[model samples]
Target: MQFFKQIKSILAVSLVLLFMAAPAIAGQPKYVFYFIGDGLGAAQRQFSEFFLQDQLKNPNSQLVMDTFEVAGINTTYCADTLITDSAAAATALASGVKTNKGVIGKDVNGNNVKTLVEEARDHGMKTGLITTTRLTHATPAAFASHNISRNNENEIADDFLNSGVDFFAGGGIRHFIPASMKIENADALGKTIKSKRKDEKDLVKGFEGKGYSTFIGMKGAKAFKSTDFSKQDKVFAAFTYTHMPYEVERMNQYKNVPSIADMTRAGIDVLAQGDKGFFLMIEGGRIDHAAHANDPSGVIWDTIAFDDAIKTAYEFFQNHKDQTLIVVVGDHETGGMGLGMDSMGYKLNMAALNDVHVSVEDTLNDGAGQYKGDKAAYLSYLSKNFGLSNLSDAEAASLNKAMVSADAGETLGYYKLNPAALTAAHILSTRANINWTTTIHTATMIPMSATGAYAGRFGGYKDNTQIAKAMAQTLGFTL
Candidate 1:
């Protein structure tokens, strides 16, 4: 008995000395905010970065990276193909495993899959998904819901409800309303039984079933695209559908809609409420859309909006400091967006055109929807909006000829294959590298940038799936 007591005293003294000499364990970074800009790749980021710096100030300069800019190369391929869509890229980012294009997180075998956000929830972290696109938009949905097909948005909505995420905001009112309230089998929607989003009563009721309490814009007031959020015991997913309106038209259509900055601030406000940390995703979705439309003004403004949102989030992260990790990247580059017309085989003057509208497909293949005075309208719109003050006489005459000729079938726009205006635009695009392909997604890798707790997870060659895995590991969730 005396020997045992002596040994116990010695062990206790040793343990105390060891603990006294040990360094403190750093606090676990309890939060992660993963942002994805769909359809935006390296070109898009380069575009936004330059335009914002050239015109607007650095919106993301709050982070340490803004002072240094830690960038990485990331390949964006889907499970089944080299090219990918939002659904596939998003799934790759949501789940660390690549899946087929058009499929959410499930394999071809149709098995359900867990996403990082889902894992975050399983680990007791509150998860919130926010986007300028629909709440069920592919990227955010990739985190919260998994359906065999991305097209089954209604089922996706149900999945979101079941996921028990604490907060969600965006459009897609069409998905939540019940089929009864919808225009069933309308003439415009021939052969398709369009799902009505009018089932607000039941839809909100469904979230309430999951211990959720809030679903906004039920009565269709103004597309609840506001920044103010409510805090309570239940899950909240709100925001009217109506495509959320384009950036240029949003202020005109919905006076109450929050700016991207406002949305960012509001999301962090609500998502940060959980004591167990939170997983929040906020998307600058329209940057990709505007690029796809080949609209420079739209792209520029939306990029500004996206940047402002990033700035807001970075500020929030700053307040929390090392307790949060932020990962911002594009799923893929859309429109093969590029910069510079130096290689286009001509020194065309874009100073003569503004809203260039010629289609390459039509001009090259006698396709439908010809230019229809594209040169004239584009020049006019450009002069009005773009403020191109350097219209040379020769350039003006050439544009005038193209407009008239296009009316008579000259096919001078990009779609026509002549690519004069595109070439001209390329000149402007390359000055800061803001060129773009036609209005479509291109097969290009996107950009990835990071900061905070796991900022080092980026800064090298990577793939889209690595983004998901990085987020998980950085947050200590480790899939």
Candidate 2:
């Protein structure tokens, strides 16, 4: 009788504690800012680590949120063969359900579903979307809209009018403008047999009409335009409707085009100020683009820049401590990028990662001018930038042959040319080293990490839907 009384007392106390905790757990403050580095894989992460290491005072220094946790999730085929595309991956991450390769925000049967972002809004949180790609790009649209095909971005962009989120950014101004305002959708037109959205609705005006504060270009943003961002709660920026210029082009052309860091900083600044807190999705969309072209230098540079953005968010959390939860991850891998091959016996010189670069566009247009062949001008430029004064005549001749697309293998172009690839190919055949099967995404698991509040749920092996479902539950919302 005495022992039975003890067991009963313990059970009664445990049940009371459980009942007492339910409301407190349900009412806990919630925040989630997810960053997707498209096509970023282990190689991209390592490359960024080393790229920043070389530039940092202490080589061991990692980006701010680097220590969260490391987990790998399998990236498999959608409706296609072995690999996946950004459209498919985005749909998987956003909707917690996988779709076919070219589809967005829907399933194989074309059923629309609840995205985490929509769930957050339904639960009354401010929402924001930011990316280095065009605003209407596949990744961003996954959370905002659904379509039978990814090519229907214009229609998807229209869907943002009703998304009711607080923030949006990136490029592709042309996509949001109708034919009356644009040579509209030339890029989309060139991709299709019949392009009907060539002249469509203006997504910018659509957002504005929906009560979003919208603008084009970083400078044109009324919020970014003034140093005082008190107006940001009432304003959101959309600088370009299409993809932002590549980092190289941005550095060379616009001089003031904000780095990924700047954009992230501004987005967080505005989003966090609200009483309801917010959910923001920022992307390094071009790291994938550069990787697809197999341009190691371009990809490396973008990876470093992406780190800059991560650092911005990392610092914010550090300041706010437990108030914010930041998760950084990648959607898929691309270009089969291998930093250093075992066959080559040369680890990429941690120092020289970005030393060699030329774009495929640059190599294709080599010796040939935009008008006619300005052979002298092109030769002078190469000599000034990349002349090898100490090569043996025979080897130099072979190299020159390769440079002009006359080599025994793949065409030598900007994406194709880089010192590391050259060295690797010299030791191993081009078929072995830097062997890009296609300019498409590959089936390599992506890494995800997180810090602050319920972060214990992250890391280790998991599936795509698991991430969304876990995050949704953590933030006190359901997907």
Candidate 3:
């Protein structure tokens, strides 16, 4: 009886151990959503949070990404330079390999590196790519195509057509159409269309032939809304000719174009139809564009749009908690953006953002041109749009000088901040305490946050390549 009792005790211990190890033995996540906020660093996110708090009049408001359980800092250096471009940074995040600047999915010696999206597709998972920039742009292209040069977007478009990715939504339909094709109709925004392709292939038609449900503009996207996604195995949507318009600009001007959240939801709906689950990459690409242009308003609104998309993914993760993994990160820091300026002495007035009615791009294109060489017109424009009042004599002179210089075709080299744009930037910065060090990418560590299955693996400081490695491990992909 004593021996039998001892045997029972041993059996109970064995059962407990097995039960404890069950999670480790279980398969990895079936769904993965990877979001890349291009040029979004810690400073950018903090600024956006502050802007949101002030804009919404809620001090307790937080970004969707800030609510994630696992958070870490990621170093964003390419093999060639400390400061990385979208191409090299994205390739590192996609392929778990370091490549030089301007290269995509290949090493310095030009060896091909398989991306996580390809791995997911190889493992029978559906794949999707959504971006506010062109689908063939560096970030999205790195995930789905390989090219020695990021500029080879024409070839990249062809690669995307053959990539087996289940869904795509963004801009750059020009790359799909042959240069020989005459485009008579305007795009969704009433902009004249022209093909950027060099070959004779109508890739859009080819995509249709391959069973992809293609949508060109706002009209097509609206039509797509009524489609039964369960019957549509593949879907592709493009809203603009090049990159999608900035969120602030889009809100104020192009109401017809789909939002980042809209594309994300559509991609999720289509990709979720697969039984084997899916890998979807959503890029807030224009944040980088705005930062490069040193447009604070544009950057802030686009980041908010990106947060909305994150909320959409978070909502989906709520239901498929056990089967999903969502990771949000940035490729690199752009514009060296900061919340406080020297003039403000650490007092950041985020409320000033609320006074601005339009973007710097809009101010340059629409307002500045109308007020060329006219100081009163420029000052009045500033007062109406950016809430600037009582401009000093020096400030007025500077504005007139800038307008005159811009009118005369004077250019600011490298950083590309023309005199007129610089004046607008200065006003916004002085009002909001926002500061920018440079109009280019910086060698800064970006924030990375994750939740759901295997999220704990991503916590703590990591290299950009490590992110790709961790996701590949979570997906059981041998990168």
Candidate 4:
């Protein structure tokens, strides 16, 4: 008996020593928050911070991402090009693989690549996707579906039915219902629902049949409270017929539309019900759209909204510090945004955007609707919406040219945006000392900031794929 007891004691001590010397398996993250700010480059992020501190004069205000413990930069080139589109960049971020532009959750050869969220679901972790763009848009689609082309949004919406995602909230209602189906209050709410799908399949009913707590439009979303989310396991909330309204537009008029932060909070509440863990991806996708339009103030507003979602995650991290990880990065930079124009010398006056009430998209696309070649009316419209009252001779001349072009239904620049709106946005940007190298994406490296559970691994320079590797490793898996 004494000999047996001695052997047992030796084995116990050896096990304790072995665990002490070995890396911690228990430290693996159970909850992960991945925030991708589409088109958020270094300059864009810095301008946002500067706007809050200097322009808004809220010196105490700080971006929640800035409070992260680890900061890093990552190269964003795709397999075929140095400058990547959102589809390819998102594939790399989601699956740690280089893919051609327009590919989602696939490799260069069109092979389906498993993504972090998919892996999380396979491991019995609940998963969610939230975005300001369509739910089937490139960034969100990469994590939940595989496709050869990002343009096949209807097919992507079909994938959502099989994605096994516990929660999803955003736009893309047009991809769900058939065109023959008409929404009751769509006209009153400014919502359209002509399905983009080739078939007459009703995806909203599919979700309902699958036991998802599905809701449509801002009105349905508003009916739920914080406590309501915790009671449901699977949820699908579509807030708009297309992409969600820009943050500026949403705050000004679309008060019913849920912000990115609202979606994040609801996702956390719902996903936390799973016994194992959860993976949630929140994207401020409108930042890219606003940037594509070269709308500086619009970009800042959406970026701030993105940070607000990050703040929501940070609050969750505070409670689950040991088992949670929050990572914020941009898939790619759009607009080639730069602070301080040559005319401004060393001064940058971002506050010029302060008086602006609505986004360029809202001003030109929704508010203005159509132009009638009335230059005075156009000027009045600009003054009413964008607060451009005292136009210099040069500014007036530029506006006059753009106004005529708009009246002729001409689109300006490579992106083919409305001539008048683009002109006004550009002029306002100049006054704010912001400049753009391109209206589209750039090869600029983006920043990554993280806090909690293996965040230190993200501190050094990395390729975009390596970001996926780090997150996968944190979750005790290989990418």
TM-score per model over all chains:
0.74, 0.80, 0.91, 0.93
Span of 10 residues, lowest total lDDT, candidate 4: 184-193
**Candidate 4 or 2, higher lDDT:** 4
Better of 1 and 3 by lDDT: 3
Expressed as tens digits, the lDDT of each residue in 1-479 for candidate 1 is 99999999999999999977642224546777777877766656655555555443554533222342567878998878787888888888887878888888776677767788888888787778778777777887788778877877777887877777887766665676566654433211111223455344456567766776454443322323432544544345454543444565454334456566666665677767787878888887777765655555456556667767777777878788778777788888777775566544444223223332332221212222233456655665545444433566765665566556555655433334333343334334543334565656667777778877757866688988887777766665554
For 1-479, candidate 4 gives per-residue lDDT tens digits of: 99999999999999999997654466788899999999999988988888878755787777889888899999999999999999999999999999999999999988999999998888789999999999999999999999999999988999999999999999888888875876655621376556677788999999999999877875565764334788887999886778888988888877777889988999999999888889999999999988888888899889999999999899999999999999999999999998887988998886688887777775674455334577788788778778678999999999889888887878877778888888888899999988988889999999999999988987779999999988888786656
- Tens digit per residue, CA lDDT, model 2, 393-415: 65455545444443234543345
Q: Per-residue lDDT for 387-449 in model 3, tens only?
A: 566676776777777888888878553555667767776677767888888888999899999
Tell me the lDDT of candidate 1: 0.63
CA lDDT, every model vs. true structure: 0.63, 0.65, 0.85, 0.86
TM-score: model 4 vs. ground truth:
0.93
Roughly what TM-score does model 3 have, to 2 decimal places?
0.91
Error of 1 at 91 (Å): 1.1
* lDDT head-to-head 1 vs 2, winner: 2
Where in model 2 is the C-alpha error above 4 Å? Answer: 1-29, 69-76, 182-197, 218-227, 234-236, 342-344, 350-376, 382-438
Span of 10 residues, lowest total lDDT, candidate 1: 184-193
Superposed on all Cα atoms, model 3 deviates from the true structure by an RMSD in Å of: 5.1
Candidate 3 local distance difference test against the native: 0.85
- Candidate 3 regions exceeding 4 Å error are 1-25, 182-185, 225-230, 362-381, 386-390, 413-415
